[model samples]
Target: MAQPHDAPTAAELVAAVREFLERDVLGSLEGRTRFHGLVAVNVLGMVERELDLGAAQDQAHAARLAELGFADDAELAAAIREGWLDGRYEELKSALLDATRDKLAVANPSYRS
Candidate 1:
């Protein structure tokens, strides 16, 4: 699905490293080393998902924040802290839920499932 280029794309390279850890590295480890390898695998999975979805997620997040009359996250947070959104609790809850779901879709899709 990628444009014409070499065989190994950046995502593929990351997947390779992740697989190596999942197989070879984890096999020879125990205790903290194994735990670290597991953590590394989780980190790599997040990285791969970010590589696939970070751009679109960024655009959606910014647009949603703008829709609430804020420029960005910091502005939105400031407004919330100042009790500006108190009258829009339902809207705020919906927006927050959508944002959290989007984040989980990247960080841990299975959890969403």
Candidate 2:
């Protein structure tokens, strides 16, 4: 919902555009154009999802990274690649799985099925 006079929120605007593309534009395209339109629709859908879920997911991701004793993804990856987390495999795997699930929840919820 919008905080100012119930005006359309950014997420609502993005959803509207995505829906318009899906309903009106995609069907009118041909070959490469249609393919590109489909990609555009998918991208818009992803954007809508991100707008809705990004904040909470970002917090969860940050917590996971902190739990792994890292400052960020780069640090976490470096630790893993350098074998620093070798002995913490299960812990690392659980945190990674949680992060992946959060990502999929926004990117493609059906993928987990």
Candidate 3:
């Protein structure tokens, strides 16, 4: 029950998550404990992956967009870059949902990516 003002450091957060999963989720499970363990491991893996490459991913995406002649005013550039950094994942998620809906209308519709 740590407040926002008591924000944990990265290591502390990882440890806390591990402890919670072990004590609350996995500890109570019997037959499905292995599945829960796998889920926990996958979650930790995803967190580690993001921590390792999040900045580099943003920089690479921005550089590619710049190379593609996406120049704009300073304010526009800042806005676009911020969206590219933070919103790309959400945008892609929405687009995927839309594509699935479109597929229901027509079989095997072409997807951009």
Candidate 4:
């Protein structure tokens, strides 16, 4: 096995591959192939964004969940489904919206606009 070095992080490696695909492979393709290549590049971009933002988003999600008095999504969902959190609908909605925006920021920042 090869030893791991810290210089090129996972995000960096993904970005390098994404750049290569966009610069070299994408320009040579046409029609459906080019479309698929674009999709692949977009997926790689999402991965890179996730690598950069996932940790902070996760922490924010957990904090939101905790603020709502739940341990995890399942618990929160159960409470909502059971109508136990009906009185806190606004609070829940705010938390959910924040979480969704965080996800959108990583998946497609344009969506937030």
Candidate 5:
């Protein structure tokens, strides 16, 4: 009997991370350092989480845009999708913040008080 190929174990992931840290991060360092190993492990975990949720995040954004009438036109929908895929996170966040501020200004003219 053999284990299923689709089911990957935690130990296997840990071993792969260890090997990556040793070969890529640690090996690139000029001297023996623990910081690079720790950083590599942390980054690897972050990347794994992002990979797992990236599609769901995009879908959620697309759905929200459609609900908000942002996707009313095919050209607009395509532009929105392109902007999302090409835009930086910080740029998107800042744009959202500005839009919120503008909405608040229109809704509450006395907000300055």
Candidate 6:
């Protein structure tokens, strides 16, 4: 976690820009420009959330796939489609839920709540 960057770190830089957009840019624009600024703010928020949660989510997903004896997502999808886990429906359901929650925690955390 050593932030050996020049001055403002990545998170700090993102925060600064987001604050600027929210406080300054958003109010100055009208019509389509304002709409686009709103979208930009949302996209920036998503990027910040991903930066916060993406690494841990990826690690957990890879570990889950490994535990399930699959090399990757495609293999897992193939197994699911072929009804290979029919007997373990509950377990599969829980795993899929966890995966979805993890993704949503980054993509749209409010939905997870």
Which candidate has the top score in lDDT? Answer: 4
Model 1, TM vs. native: 0.88
**Candidate 6 has which clashing residue pairs, if any?**
none
* Cα lDDT of model 4 by residue, 4-78, tens digit: 767677888999999999999999999999999999999999999998888899999999999999999999999
Give the worst 10-residue stretch by lDDT in candidate 1. Answer: 1-10
Query: Residue 24 in model 3: shift from native, Å?
Result: 12
Q: For residues 9-106, could you state the per-residue lDDT of candidate 1 as single tens digits?
A: 87888889999998889989999988998999999999989888888999988888877888888988999999999999998888888889889988
Model 2's lDDT to the true fold?
A: 0.89
Q: CA lDDT, every prediction?
A: 0.88, 0.89, 0.54, 0.92, 0.55, 0.86
TM-score of each: 0.88, 0.89, 0.39, 0.92, 0.36, 0.87
Root-mean-square deviation (CA) per prediction: 2.4, 2.0, 12.7, 2.6, 12.7, 1.8
Superposed model 6: Cα runs more than 4 Å off: 1-7
List residue ranges in candidate 4 displaced over 4 A: 1-4
- Count steric clashes of candidate 6: 0
lDDT of 6 by residue, 1-113 (tens): 34565766676778789889999889989999999999888888888888778889899999888878788999999999998989988878878899999988877789986
> Which 10 consecutive positions of candidate 6 have the poorest summed lDDT?
1-10
- The sequence of per-residue lDDT tens digits that candidate 3 reaches over residues 1-113 is 23554656564677677667767777666667768685875576456445555566556545544643454335435755677545466654553355344333233224323
lDDT of 1 at 59: 91
Cα deviation at 32, candidate 3, in Å, is 2.6
lDDT of 1 at 75: 89
Per-residue lDDT of 33 in model 5: 61
Q: Candidate 5 lDDT, tens digit per residue, 39-90?
A: 6666665555444544665565566455444653465447657774354556
Q: Judge candidate 3 at residue 57 and give its lDDT.
A: 56
Candidate order by TM-score, decreasing, is 4, 2, 1, 6, 3, 5
Best by TM-score: 4
Candidate 2, position 47, lDDT = 89
Question: What's model 4's TM-score?
Answer: 0.92
